[model samples]
Target: MTLNRRIFMIQSLLGTVSLTVGDQAHTEIPVLFEDDSQARNLGYKEDSRKVDTAKFPKYSAGQKCAECQWFKALPEGSTGTCGVFSGKRVNRNGWCKSFVHKE
Candidate 1:
């Protein structure tokens, strides 16, 4: 095995591995709040404070999707999948009428 040949093989393997990891990391970003009709009807916001308190009296301060019962998974980002959103990403600090207390 020549030195150059060994290095080339190692580099090829690394490149393939990196590509696979990158693709897996971002398969398909779930729909955003404004893109989904259900979220829109419920007054979903990326920031809970942006919710119209006058129209949605149920929304209170400090209520976020991450803390809601409907939230399925909240990775380390501001976006997350919720039961109500159905393949859409809701805000960690977002609020909607569907928000429920997490038991």
Candidate 2:
């Protein structure tokens, strides 16, 4: 009886730990990096101010992800989901060629 109880308890502990780790992995959205292939193609800059205007003439001062139509601001943190980057989070101050004013 004692051995059975110990086995059950150990299994329960392992199950709980596994669930917690899995939940965290699923719930966390990965942050988009400027060096990412897709990001580089789109001229994504983590900070709009860092964007190279000579290379991307369409970019203008004050343009940022937070003000763009593709961005969905999260309840917490400076990072938010961008329609341009599926399953990835972008900095609120980030900029990309896909930017469009949120009307």
Candidate 3:
């Protein structure tokens, strides 16, 4: 192959490899928090975008995410199931009245 053609091929191969690596690095883990009777009873919905402590009377300052029984601290981030929810990812910054300290 000519010098120009060889260089072009090499560049193309490198681009493809870089794209593959980037795609693999971005794999997303599904959020573990879902709708639960506990959340529902507390006025929290599965589709709720966020926990509004101001609007929700159940939310209190003592009931922060870190204190929750289900809060799992991972290297990447904290995620875990809520007592009310069967399976879902609650934010580490989340708070609810049902929050219980994990032993």
The digit string of per-residue lDDT tens for model 3 on 1-103 reads: 5669889999999999999887554234355333555555655433333667577866654455656675664445655445544445565666655666777
| Per-residue alpha-carbon lDDT of candidate 2 for residues 74-100, written as tens digits (9 for 90 to 100) | 757698889999899999999999999
The global C-alpha lDDT for each of the candidates, from Candidate 1 onward, is: 0.78, 0.92, 0.58
Better of 2 and 3 by TM-score: 2
RMSD of each: 5.5, 6.2, 9.0
lDDT of 1 by residue, 6-95 (tens): 899999999999988876663475657564777778888888878888999998888888899888665557567778877666777778
Can you tell me which runs of candidate 3 are displaced by over 4 Å?
Answer: 1-29, 32-40, 44-58
Task: Give each model's clash number.
Answer: 0, 0, 6
Error of 1 at 48 (Å): 0.3
Please give the ranking of all candidate structures by TM-score, highest first, separated by commas. Answer: 2, 1, 3
